[model samples]
Target chain A: MATDDAGESLAEVGEFAVIERLVAGRRQPDAVAVGPGDDAAVLRAADGRTVVSTDMLVQDRHFRLDWSTPHQVGRKSIAQNAADVEAMGARATAFVVAFGAPADTSADLALELADGMWHEAGLLGAGIIGGDLVSAPQWVISVTVLGDLDGREPVRRTGARPGDTVAVCGELGRSAAGYALWHNGIERFDGLLGRHLVPEPPYGQGRVAADAGATAMTDVSDGLLADLGHIADGSGVGIGLRTDALSADRDALAEAAAALDVDPMAWVLGGGEDHALVATFPQAPPNGWTPIGRVLDGPPRVLVDDAAWQGNPGWQSFD
Target chain B: MATDDAGESLAEVGEFAVIERLVAGRRQPDAVAVGPGDDAAVLRAADGRTVVSTDMLVQDRHFRLDWSTPHQVGRKSIAQNAADVEAMGARATAFVVAFGAPADTSADLALELADGMWHEAGLLGAGIIGGDLVSAPQWVISVTVLGDLDGREPVRRTGARPGDTVAVCGELGRSAAGYALWHNGIERFDGLLGRHLVPEPPYGQGRVAADAGATAMTDVSDGLLADLGHIADGSGVGIGLRTDALSADRDALAEAAAALDVDPMAWVLGGGEDHALVATFPQAPPNGWTPIGRVLDGPPRVLVDDAAWQGNPGWQSFD
Candidate 1:
């Protein structure tokens, strides 16, 4: 159980002992009544409703050990799941993680992973309440986030209507662009590469958007066009984006696009995993959010400059 | 999204379409305010508290496709996670599952897995609220359960005291016995073999134990002795088990043990995954639970008939 041995393999330390080390000295939030050393964790849901979501990151698929440190993978796992909760107009309170890795993996790596998770949870003032560790052929992490809505109605994707303004808060296309940089072995874009590894989701902006009377909300996980298409389809209303409004995002990625000989607008429109909060509002957007589009009275679809722009739409798991 | 084309591989159908098939037509319980479609699901936790737990099952480690159907694996995944909440004296209200598999895996298998999960969740009046699906090299399923404590104190494993009786509700060793029978290719124990595929945890006994004043509680997940040792160590008390108290369990697996030329007591003491509820009580244990041991005022350890039993204690993830 001692944290002194940083080089031991998980098999050498054993499950219970490794668990002891992973759980040692970690501070849990006040909302957690019963923490890790129990059959299940008990968390306060003060407003009578609990918002829940889950996401799994697979080795070589969701992340690469060679490209990412265990810490970054852990952070990405927690951040992505937390983004889902944020999209629901809730503040993430706690997380329960289940991790699987080969037996030969270092216990230190697992500890580092936990440390990264703790760091991310701390940013949101949340706790990693309970987890299960197991042996697998490759590292796989599944994180489930629990969120607090503070008695507000969840901002669902079905609430957008005609005449509503669509806005976004946080960076867009950085993750996809970062992936290109990493994949192409171009190390010059340090900030973009780091953003891809550990995304900075506009955490509390979700509740702000909710309070601002946003009609619908979702996080941009599967590219701007693809994710907004979900909102459009769900709300049975079309969405029209102004290219001029997304010019800043395009400009941000312009240097990288020129370096890669690619279109910067493609990354801005079709890139994913930036975890930016996008919502539709009937009035002027919230202060921190930038209005880039509007809901329209038409069949469900997403248009660029009021026209269907052709390119890669977005990511799909199987693809 | 149509269920008729069950033969297509996940890659051919894509992620969102497969998710639509998985989510369609499932009736959610009243506790679910928003289910499946949204970025996150919302559930009412009437008592201001939520009990949460998670587990991961990897291919050829936790289960096998050749030996168990996708449905069985799904049921096992949900059942095991639900048991953890049950051990905490709460009724599981909803679940969010994250699953990974090869792109070539049939979409039908995924649906069958959801069917199996739904079948098991139905037993507890819970619903599958949300999930993520991704591509991986092999099948990996992670399930997170949410439960309501209904205003009662959560029964933790640190409450046992000297002189308290240890009891168990639900079958013991059946899963291990079934494993041994299947391993040896001696297929006489039909009941045990089926149990190995899908465990039957005593659904409502955790609350019953809590209502009956159980001081310390945990599920028999890592085996009776190993899990009870958790209680013993957490509560700073020793435990003494009476073999006579476990005679019924031994008898149940007697034929299978003989056929495999193994000791029935070993399975009763060391086997796991039966998901039986084990707790320590200050007074007589409630009906439907069999008394198996007593807490001793000494160092933390487990003994059989007042002495340590020399055999395999239980399971470890790395092992």
Candidate 2:
């Protein structure tokens, strides 16, 4: 099915032609003052400040091509980076990606990946402004997201104080439970399996939390407790989570946990990659946000129901 | 020499600890409203527009550890991305890096890489805001830079027209010549070899050209003629280089070409990664810019001494 002009491999089509094809016919958002084809892209920051973050996903380490379509990989890459911006109490406006793949990969696959990125970016009303493509032994996608704070002060992890209510605004444990199902080769939970491939981050919720006066915020990239540990350490306060409050999350994954013979609490407490928005508030949380715990006095640790539960803390890059 | 805690590999130190060591006690610029340790960094844009760009460097393909120290690699990464911002007629203000390395790498080496990045960023009064670290089979560094345009209209590649003089600032052919010398194992031209590892882009000259009424501009990341071909194609015009005007650039690389048995003109016309600023001007060129070519009517092509070149055009990622 290979054509003489299109090439059988990326090496055949070459990097420049592939990049040109990837960039062709794509529409940029209004916020983008200057788009791709230049050394850099210029984006308008209406509020005079920009919130920025970056994430890297390596093949086999982050995802297996056999399990995820290139489109799903692209969406996941964009979603995860966008989540970081959301965690900062800002709205993502633009993204610049740097992708590396083997030379023999099909050009069509790369286009599908770009399409997936565009699909996800469209959801946020953001644009893919610029990117660099290169040859590597495997696929490696690195994304950097720029966001606007809308003149509001940033909600940092170091701002949480004792007695602040800890709340969350998205699903948790589904991705980790999906990982378990995928590892065990149990395909019964289709939704959970899909969640592992592409996460559903609650868009526009960061601004909502900021408007509701969030004292501190973060995304659940690492397990809930592990991510909370960062806030505790950064803010120098203890964080205590209530298991009763997370029963809904645990129940959602009870079936998968049973199939894998693991504690559902482990997934609820220690699993990660759900991209859930977690924030602390001095008063009642805004709509769609459910209170899960409270900030405690000094000691700098994340506790489960007032006690330190012993289990796998969270995912480690080396591990 | 291998102490347990002192020289532990990245895997032993873990991602969090390694990051803590990398970011510990580093000073950030005043523009950085938020730095590392948060889910994202917040930077002041001041001018309501942020210029963004991304570049990926792969080990073996982009740089060899044998030829460059981790510090040089870091400097090269930051410098190249900063050149992209400068080309857009903006001042680089901040950067975010996503670095992937094997788990077996030493933590000291990563800290050294960060040290080099900070050193290069300091040249432009910019700060590294945030970054991501993950495990990979080899080293892959991706850098995204954000710049401030200060209310100036962005100089685009599609703005050049017929009757415009093409001018270039900074040296050309030196990086490619240095690469050739290093590839051929000729050590006579140490400065040329160093230039290959870390390009010296003409800093702040892009804004100067833009202020002086240049029509279009781009950085010479690819070879001069090849990069000019982009300007020609984007601007829908032809570019004719006057070889006699490039005598100074040729003379600078003659000794290196003689040492490596390659044509100095080939390096000047077809070498990439020098990152010199090339632009089109309707009138006399700006101070610091030297006239090298002229834009022609109709067809989009780059001519060397008014004739089609018969050599390698430039670099492609896959090739």
Candidate 3:
């Protein structure tokens, strides 16, 4: 189980021994009563409710080993899943990861992946309680995040009614722009490309939005327009956006857009994976939140500047 | 979202539309307050605790598309994760699945997989509360199960003492024997080969074992010897198996073993993936459980008939 003797494949080390190395010297959080090395992990949910979500990332589809290190993939996996918990107006307490990779993969790479997961979990004060490791043709990671509601009513998507102000926090269009840069083989936008690899979700902002009495909340994963459509469709209310209000976000991506000869507004409107927190507030949103739209009295639809702006709505997995 | 079109691929149907088809017509259990349609699902956990576990399955590695139906793979995925919950002395309430597969895959196959999961979950009175669908090079399914303990204490591996009787419920060595039959192209044992595709764990036996005062328990995911060795190492006790008590299991695999020209006892003692429940009871195990071994005071090791048995210990992911 020792990493001192290197250059062995995972199959040579065996599953149990590799597991021993993956699990060694890691500290579990207080919420985990029975951590890994058990049949199942026991996590305390004092509020009598557990917010759960899952996301699977396949190699080359969700990430590229050539573009990002195993550590970044690990962080991105946890961060994206954690963003879901945050969108639910809950704080993630623990995660159980299931990883599949080729047998010849280095144990050190797996360790670095775990290290990345631990680092991301630490940022949110959570732990990786349990996991399953398996062999696959390519790297596949599935993360399930368990979140605590802290005795608050889960801010569901159905709660956004007429006249609620739509607000967002954290970066927008950054990940999409970063992807564009990396895809185009541009090297000038170091920060944008890095952001695409490892996103910085506005941690704890979910709790703050919840405490501020936000009615409905979700994270921007499938672009602003597409994700807001979820709230619109779920709440059965139309949302109208002010293009002027999103100028700041458009400006943030302007340089990258110019370099790519693309419309910056398109990135701001249709880019995904920034993991920014977007919510609907019956009153003024909390500090550091930007108001961009308002829930309207109409059919379930999203409008840009009181009109339909026809562009690429957002990302879809099969596309 | 409707799957009215008979021959559309996942890419043609699209991710959101495919997800809608997969989730359609499924009734969630009472424990799910909010199911699907949001960033996360909220499950009721009135016990102030939730038991969690996860497992991942990859195509051509964990399962073969030619050998097993998509439905069988789905059942196997859920059944194994449910077994982990059952091992914790908890009743599985909800499951969240993350699935990845090729874009050109048939959408109906995806529905069949969901149907299989729902059918298996119905066996435990649980629900497939939420799921995510994405594109991958091959099929990768990850399932996270959430369970409620119903106020009973979790039977952990560290609680087995020197004198506790090791008892087991459900079939053993069937999957391994079945794997051998399939590998050798022997089609004589229908039951064994079918079992290799979908394991039937003693559905409610974890709670039964707990009610009968089981001190420690685990599922036989790996070989019984390897999993029991985990208990031995965790509890600081040795496990001594009575081969006489395992004659029934060996006999069950004898026909398959004879066809493969292998030892049936080796399969019974060292096979895994049957997902049978193995527990340590201070007294007699509950009715319907078979006594197979005893705990002893010594270093952590597994002995067969008071002596070391040289054989394959169990299945490991890497190996």
Candidate 4:
């Protein structure tokens, strides 16, 4: 719900009025044939193929309202969903969001969330075509992204083969590092703390990697090793990550790790939510991508320097 | 997450295992070029246009867990989103769901939710392609439906004219009556209580109405008066409803209304979430549709019996 600068609550502004305010003055791309205020929005999938993915963020569970502004939460929601599309070697075309909050939540906060979504979508030249608003006990944001593959075959998780080189094309462990910093209430490392709230995924690298003959792709939503384990399981191949290949990432995080009195390697290898594009290429990867591992012919498993490491593989929702 | 049919909880099953269990044994339609297990699911929109809409259901706000089984909740989520697509004169083809719930929730409850979704999708020949599972303080489900226009122009809400007849193609007031019954702890009338739990929109009627020269269309999501008000405002015209025309819906709920000591007409005219397709047609509505009102050529508003309605208009999220 929204109103003028008088600072009205969502409950006071009403649902329809808030929707009108959110949609007004917003520009939609050519792909959006029909925008908001309709029963459903029609989007032109020029490539005829639509890549769809969904993700949900709960207050305190995924993001804390106290740690992030509504705008950042909105941006993170869109960014993570966009990362999913990017992982499929597709370009995001549009997004539809569903947000829920208590009735007493401010209309300004609601609009701020939309502003954040538009900001993130604008980064990739996409649009927020439609959304739903509802009342709930706590804040919850769920985003669904639609993308166009533009005639390219989707790079799947099961396409990795023996001799494939595993590479990553975005920051590693930064979000986790930031998360740790935030958890410990550290005041230093503003950049790292910011990254934890809003990740910068390698937006177009999935298509670049695909064009370069990458066989398999996925975003590192979970830790790198854990996400690679999915690719390994999907492809029925073993993956070996060389520590030397990841030394740069470790060094990048060394300062943060030292400040926290933790091992940089743990964050570099086991941390997640960076939304980094990780793929397996049969040959050399495209520029800006770093080769960190290789596929091996064996049962599905991921290794660090040809050996299993006794550490947490990645995040487990329940655990 | 999931395991053998041993009645394991979601916490015990884990996110990945629960997803595997939910997606396993499910068949994806041909339009689904690529299904689950990827960062995103690829859907083939041969018509080149995708109709997208989203809706969110919170645990207590939308449906009480004690009042509804997980299966019913799943069906309601899909049904409501699909109804939006149907209102646009499109057939829902694919859906992506993002579900959040307490970690200790039973894995079987999660599967039951999926089963209910599949059952509803099967009715429309659609598929549930991809999803995300995360831990939340309470259950939250957000669904986005991708529909195909099949080359037909979408019937929007801004096209009704003075001479068009207003008609509806599904039950009305049943959900409201059911809700009231449930709220009053009236144990009798299982059908009314069930209607509150799950609405049965007249599926496939949207395209039928579009093909039969419907000038404007929308789902009765927020009561006949309120939803028609949307059309009136969008079309910049007035709408007048005939009480006699909606006598059938009133009659259907009369017994329940009498038992509950409330006016049946209030439920018929103001209740929402029935997902009934209400449209303005240039002529008598096609078979299976019942006329209820007429379009007026004047200031935008909805009037009952040539006068403004004094009862509650409809449901509002914040209100």
Per-candidate clash tally: 0, 1, 0, 4
Error of 2 at B31 (Å): 1.3
- Candidate 4 residue runs with Cα over 4 Å from true position: A1-6, B1-6
* lDDT tens readout by residue for model 2, A39-143: 899899999999999999999999888788889999999999999999988999989999998888888888888999999999999989999999888899999
Tens digits of per-residue lDDT, candidate 1, A1-319, equal: 2223359899999999999999999999999999998999999999999999999999889998888888898899999999999998999999999999999888999999999999999999999999999999999999999999998999999999999999999999999999999999999999999999999999899999999999999999999999999999999999999989988999999999999999999998898999999999999998999999999999999999979989999999999
- The runs of at least 3 residues in candidate 3 whose Cα sits more than 4 Å from the true structure, single-residue gaps closed, are A1-6, B1-6
User: Which candidate wins on lDDT?
Assistant: 1
List model 4 lDDT by residue over A4-30, tens digit each. 235787899999888988898999999
Native contacts matched by each model: 0.96, 0.94, 0.95, 0.93
Cα-based lDDT at residue A209, candidate 1? 95
lDDT of each: 0.93, 0.90, 0.91, 0.93
**Predicted candidate 3, C-alpha RMSD:** 2.6
What residue pairs are clashing in model 3?
none
lDDT of 1 by residue, B71-130 (tens): 999999999999999999999999999999988888999999999999999999999999
Q: For every candidate, how close is chain A to the native chain A in TM-score?
A: 0.98, 0.97, 0.97, 0.97
Lowest summed lDDT window (length 10), candidate 4 chain A = A1-10
DockQ of each: 0.93, 0.88, 0.88, 0.89
lDDT string for model 3 (B186-224, tens) is 888899999999999999999999999999999999989
Q: Interface root-mean-square deviation for each candidate? A: 0.5, 0.8, 0.7, 0.7
**Docking level of model 1:** high
lDDT of 4: 0.93
